[model samples]
Target: MIELLVNLIVSVMAAATPLLLAATGELIVEKVAVLNLGVEGMMLMGAIAGFAVAHETGQLWLALLAAIAAGMTLSFLFAVLTLTLQANQTATGLALTIFGRGFSALVGAGYVGIAAPTLPKIHLPVLSDLPFFGATLFSYDPLIYLALILLAATAYFLTRTHAGLILRAVGDQHDAAHVLGYRVIRIRYLAVLFGGAMAGLAGAYMSLSYTPLWAQDMIAGRGWVALALVTFAAWRPFWLLIGAWLFGGIMYLSLYVQGLGVPVPSAMLSALPYVGTVVVLVLISRDHRRIRLHRPAMLGRPFQATN
Candidate 1:
């Protein structure tokens, strides 16, 4: 039983990695009051690009880099449309998601059934070879640790840094930020690109680490879940980690239970994460004031500088 429990814990952490990374990125993006809904799209593009590059070049790092570039490229398009052209953020984000889905599918056609090299685990000397706890906690790919570091960095940046203060000020009141001579558009552009890069890294993890292969629509709505996670976390980085792990535990549990021959429907198991997302959103939405307090004041609104 203890071994089984250990295995479950490890699986849950692995499952949560991608969501955690994506949510961290979105937290930064929304911190600057720019809502980029192309996370799913960016992730898909990253998955395909990472898989293709890794498959052909046998270089995992290059594959990950390709994924980041793919994600940033899509995000740049989003920035241009919304920040420069003042397009509707919602419509453009949705369209970008659709475009990513189709584009990734077309790009991944030849790579179907191709198996790329899996990401290597960093086996520390004494820590990795210890008993159950060591294997459970220390045996994951590098990206897992990177996610935790990212969470810490994000929390510190938002709470303890001057630049973070500037970002929050810009998000809370872009016009006020503009009045203070801060470049609101440029800040938001950087935030969006960062968000996209994180999302892409998450996608690359799916292909090069999680499943280690590519398939059509392989991101499988993880992007949307990450988006919902931002609300579940109430826009805080620490809470985002909790929400992501909770959802990840639930997702992994569903699969574990199915494997136990509980006679549960596979469809129901698959729906667990989405159902959890709804429940979380509903619970958080019940307190309108709390939502108002943490939410960026200028989110989803376009900014323009007037001379």
Candidate 2:
């Protein structure tokens, strides 16, 4: 029983890590009042880039870096259009996603069906040998720990630092922030780029650690789930962790049940996580006050600096 429980926890954490990473990046972007709907596309690009690099070179670090670069490259385009040229954020972001999808598919065509090495798990000498705690807590790959560390750092940055306050200020009132010499466009650019890096890292995690192979649209709808996760978290980092795990468990539940010889249809089981996502969003939407209070005021709004 204990072994079974530990395995479940490990699986759920693996499932949750990518969602947590992607959502955390989106949360940062939204905090700066910039909404990039291209997260799905970014993740897809990262996945293919990471998979291709690892398959060719067999260097994990290079693959991860490649993933981040691919994501940032796409986001740089997003920044130029929306932040610099005053394009509509929503439309530009949608276009970015579409472009990422087609681009990744085209690039990944040659790499399909190829397998790559997975991330190495950490094995502490004595600690990792411990029966329950070792496997449950200390045995995960580095990215899992990095995700948690990043979340903690983000929470601290947003709530306990001067720069964080400035970021919130920009999101709340960009013009006012501009008047105060905060450089609203610059700060937002950094936020968007950081979001892209994180999304890329998340995509790498999916390909290198989760499945270790390339597949068309293997990200499925995880990018969308991460978006909904931000709202489910009410833009709070701590809640984002909770929500990621919840969704992760839901995602893994179908496989677990099927493995146990449950009679549920595979299609329905596959739909469980998305169904849970819709249900959670509907429930959360009913609470108008919470969302209004927590949502960034300048979110999805274009910023124009006046001299």
Worst 10 residues of 2 by lDDT: 130-139
After TM-score superposition, the amount by which residue 132's alpha carbon in candidate 1 deviates from its true location, in angstroms, is 3.8
Q: What TM-score does candidate 1 reach?
A: 0.98
Worst 10 residues of 1 by lDDT: 131-140
Query: What tens-digit string does per-residue lDDT give for candidate 1 at 68-109?
Result: 999999999999999999999999899889999999999999
Alpha-carbon lDDT, every model: 0.92, 0.92
- Each candidate's root-mean-square deviation in Å? 1.0, 1.1
* Highest-scoring model, lDDT: 2
**How would you encode candidate 2's per-residue C-alpha lDDT over 190-297 as one tens digit per residue?**
999999999999999999999888898989989989999999999999999999999999998988987777878889889999999999999998999999999999
Clashing pairs in 2: none
